[model samples]
Each structure stands twice: as structure tokens, then as C-alpha cells.
Target: MASLGQMAAQSDMVQGLNAGLRRVPPWVLYLAGAGWAGWLFYLAATGGLGVEPIEALEHRYGELALQLIVVGLAVTPLRRHLGVNLMPFRRAIGVLTFFFVLAHFLVWAILDVQTLSAVWADILERPYVTIGMGGFLLLLPLAVTSNNWSVRKLGGAAWRRVHKLVYPAAVLGAVHYVWLAKGFQIEPLVYLGLILVLLALRSRPKATRLAR
Candidate 1:
């Protein structure tokens, strides 16, 4: 039947993709992600962002950070459930996400706030800002311990325990976006839903393990 043939074709396509991704150098992914970010910054510098460039720039960084964070979280599930191995690139993705978060914060602090007193005040007065800063703080430790040197220094168990902060950081990051919006926006809701699904997928296997 046509449905059976279509399923076969799709399987072949997915197999081809998995093979190609496995062959590609891990550094290429980091280079491409960082390069695109640099391109966005270049555009912002050149007035190509249209109208409110600073706000556009901040959104660009923040969105990329959230996306990369989700992607990093999805790697294990993708490999285990979908048989698409992304283990090699997971570290690069996490580091890139942290840098994107840092860029998002700096853009808001420097271009948007422009004053130390106001920055502190906004952090205290604005609930979204407060939650955003909390998310950043959670990521800070994971970012610092991402390197091989730190891994050896901290030992595997300790390192993994610290890295577990990614879960709460991701939740807070999504919540910050939802609260940041002026009204009930669909985009933020979609992101929040996606993260919740990913978290649920991640937890199910653990719950099964704990029961045994």
C-alpha cells in the first residue's frame, strides 16, 4: 500500500540523516551556532534589525538560549527513544546555551538598563527580571563545570549532581518568558508546553527505574 511505501521511505531518510550526523565533526556544530550568533550581532550593529534593534537583539539572544537549552535537554531522550545519538554534541550545546543567556542578560543590562542603580532596581522590582536572574544563577555553576578539567576535579557523581540544576533552570527560564510577555501570548505558551513535555519524557524513565 501507499502508506507502507511512505513509511519505508521515511525510515530510509531518517537512517541517512542519522549516519550523516554521526560522521560530522562535533566542533562544526559549535562553530555554526556561534557563527550564526555573530551574524545576528553584526546585523544589529549595522542597523539591519529594523525599528527597535536593541529589543530585537535581546529577543534573538533570549530565544536562542531557551531553544538551545531545550535541545540540550532533549539529547538523551532523542538518543534513547528515537535512536538519534547526540551525546557527542551535548556539551557544546550546553556551553553555547549559557553564552547565549549571558548575551541576553548583557544586552538588557547595558543597552536596556544603562545604569547600575536601575539594573539593581529592576532586578528587585520586576518579577520577570528576578526570575530571569535566578535562572541565570542556576546556569552559572553548570557552565563553570562544563570543562573536562572541572569534571575530573569534581568527580562524576558530584559533577552530575551539580549539572542537574539544568532542570530547574529550564523551568524558570520558560516561566520568565511567560511572565515577560505583556498579555497571554501563544509563543510563550508553546515554549512552556514544549519544555514541560520534554521534562515529562525525561522523568518517566527515571520513575520506572526507581520502581524496580
Candidate 2:
């Protein structure tokens, strides 16, 4: 699917979006992420959630987390391939992704399951939960190291090496999504395939074209 970017490039939307984005302070992106979660909560509080609200909440959280993860993964590609700069928001993107993942886990463990024991039991018995938890754990260190302090402490190269854990973490996230879906759903598989392609793109070596 073509992103809004592609559509906007061919229309007036790009200018409007860029103008709106410029008017917002850099820090406000954090608030936007928080506001999104708040809106979801508001919906739930007001009984706006559908028949299977718990599932809906879980799906939304996990999906947003994955989408944000993919966003982080796309930053490099956008810069390298399209010359679009998203570097400024990458850290916030990562942090918010982890927040959503944590929220999803909490929703499952508290609101849905309603017990620590059951949470533990589900973690042990459910493959999807196990994989999802593993991915979340992998993201923990990256989130912790995202700040300038950790970058200085670990050295830039070493920090980058450690952060490479995100590749596996993203892969595991997709696998968890696929396993959790009922029957043979194409959506999760599509996400997995897209992740694979993005990772492959990242792995390729850059080359310069020779003069004719």
C-alpha cells in the first residue's frame, strides 16, 4: 500500500501536513502518543468499546506497537532511499512503541486475565505470549539505552551493536502476531513479510554507480 506520503507527494496534503507538523513543538509528539492511549481509554471508560472490547484493546495496542516498531525500522530507509528526514522523532517513536507494548501486556495481565498467577501461567503455556514477552524484553534494553547518557557510557559503536537486538525483536513481534491470529489470517503474515523485506533492505551493502 502506498503511504500517505506517496499520496501527499502528488497533492496538496504534503504542504498541509508539513505545515501542521512544523507548528507543533518537537516534544508534543510524546503528548500525541499519550493522547492516543488516553482516547482509547476514554472510549473504554465510556462503554464505546465493542462487544469484545478486551480483544479490541489488545489488538489495538499490539498493532500500534508493531506499527511504531516498523516506523523506527523505516527511518533509515526513508533517509537513505528517499532523503526524508525522520531522525528527530526516532527516539520518541521507539520509547512510545515500548510504552504501547507495556500497555498491551498490562491489559492482558490485569484487565483481561485479572491475576498475576494467570499471567504467569499464560506466559508459560501460550506461545504467542512467550514470543511477545521475549520481544518486549529485547526492547527493554534498547529503550533504556536510547538516551545520550547511555550512548556516551557505552560508546556509540557498542551502543549500536547492542541496539541491533531490535531486528530480532521485530521479527519475534511479527511471529507473535501471526501465532496469535485465529485460523490462517493474511494480515499478520503480511506484516511478517514486510518486516523481512525491510530487514533485507537494511542488510544490503551500498554501492556507487560508476561514471559512464
lDDT of each: 0.91, 0.85
User: Tens-digit lDDT track for model 2 on 16-125?
Assistant: 65456556675787899999988997777677778778877877888999998888899888767755557778888889989899888888888899989889998999
Per-residue lDDT tens digits for candidate 1, residues 12-104, read 876887888889888998898889889999999899898788999999999999999889989988877877778889899999999999999
Residue range with the least summed lDDT across 10 consecutive positions in model 2: 203-212
Native-to-model Cα distance after best TM-score fit, residue 50 in candidate 2, in Å:
1.3
Error of 2 at 87 (Å): 0.6
Best candidate, lDDT-wise?
A: 1
TM-score of 2: 0.85
RMSD of 2: 4.8
